[model samples]
Target: MDRATWDRVQVLLGQFVYRSHQMRYAGELIHCGHCGSPITGETKTKKNKKTGGDKQYVYYRCARYNDEDHPRIRMTEAEIDEQILALFDRMRVEDEEFRNTFREQLRRATNWDLGTETKNED
Candidate 1:
């Protein structure tokens, strides 16, 4: 096959594989805090009354949400994204002391590598 055709085939195959396993955060990425079960992802379609168009929304929820004692809470993908962003914001290292320590470690590693190389040359 030609180069362009081969590239197109590869793209189509990749899309097919992705669709076959469409769950984005259902496996080991997320787990239920309440039940300790893996979170599952699902797509819900809602029909817009005015435009008669279907809007699809992705949601993540505990796999045991339907169980008797599990909390019946489902979080939209957007909500999960916001929570993740907030977590990252909270985890950001802004301390000057930490920065200095990291710089020192990097400098030491570089110096050690240089020393090893010089010794090997002897």
Candidate 2:
């Protein structure tokens, strides 16, 4: 891809990361949505070890697959960001009240009072 396109992808991916951590999945920021593996550097392709069957697929990789300790399923940053945008589009058309309440929850939940448990760690 050209530099301009790549730059745009970076912006969208950044938004995806923020929205995912704050709006949807808290403290569970992670790899590509398709494979659930880390995106290494700016490379556009990854060797994805996909899981699930038929329509339920999860991509991931183990250490043995990549010759590295952190074996991550591979997917393009652009692809993953596109998925996030799709989600954002759907949520944008959802109920207005729901969106407001969701934002309110995000605000309240952001301030830590020592009682909050992370979504994945707990």
Candidate 3:
């Protein structure tokens, strides 16, 4: 909620920007759920209402849904992550290089910008 907190979030999220294997998705956040066209990017915010008040999560929803012209289904963050992870789990084991890259990328993301922020007692 303060400047220091925002700065930390920015830095942590920044680390995730330039990576290869971590990006298992074939399309950017801009891509539409139907036509596969580029749309607006995901928006980030602090989810203070959650149980842990986790600040790390960044969420995106298609803006086209709000448009009267384009009516489409909205998806959840958990759903999206599940789909990507499922795809990765099913990735061809014959490709040793790809599997290795996936492993390495997962390791990097797990360790990246990790730090403890205090839990809100109120």
Candidate 4:
């Protein structure tokens, strides 16, 4: 395959594997609060000779870590999951206007247009 085709194939394969891993670890769904980029997870396994098994370590890292100015930011999967859960617990959903705004933002992010009527009504 040409370099472009090979690159595209590699990207597609990586996406498939990442999505599969994400489904298995749902609570790890997170984006970078700093740059709005999706976060990716990495796993490392080491052999444990005594137990005849592998020790696994998982990390959730920001995707925009290419810049040296931005220090590498990462968290253990468990830590990030727990922190997210805690955030949800403390979050308040009582603001109607905020909820509506957030819903509209989500719709826009998905490229769904809000009709003029809806805007006028708002």
Best by TM-score: 1
Q: Residues 1-115, candidate 4, lDDT per residue (tens digit)?
A: 3554344334333422222133223233456778877777766666657898865555566777676766577665335434533443455779978766644443342222112
Candidate models: Cα lDDT each? 0.54, 0.36, 0.45, 0.47
TM-score of each predicted structure versus truth:
0.55, 0.26, 0.38, 0.47
Structural RMSD, model 2: 14.8
- On residues 1-122, what C-alpha lDDT tens digit does candidate 1 reach at each position? 35543443343334322231245456656779987888888776667588998755566788888998788898754355345434434554689788566445534433442342212110
Candidate 4 has what TM-score?
0.47
Candidate 2 positional error at 9, Å: 9.6
Error of 3 at 92 (Å): 0.9
Model 3 TM-score, 2 decimals = 0.38
Please say which candidate is ahead in lDDT: 1 or 3: 1
- lDDT by residue (21-122, candidate 2, tens digit) is 122211223433444544333212223358532221222222233654443444322334345444444555368887776544433333321123212110
Give me the runs in candidate 1 sitting further than 4 Å from their true place.
Answer: 1-23, 92-122
The parts of candidate 3 lying over 4 Å away from their true place are 1-30, 42-57, 69-79, 95-122
Off by over 4 Å in 4: 1-28, 93-122
Backbone clash tally for model 1?
Answer: 0
Clashing pairs in 4: none
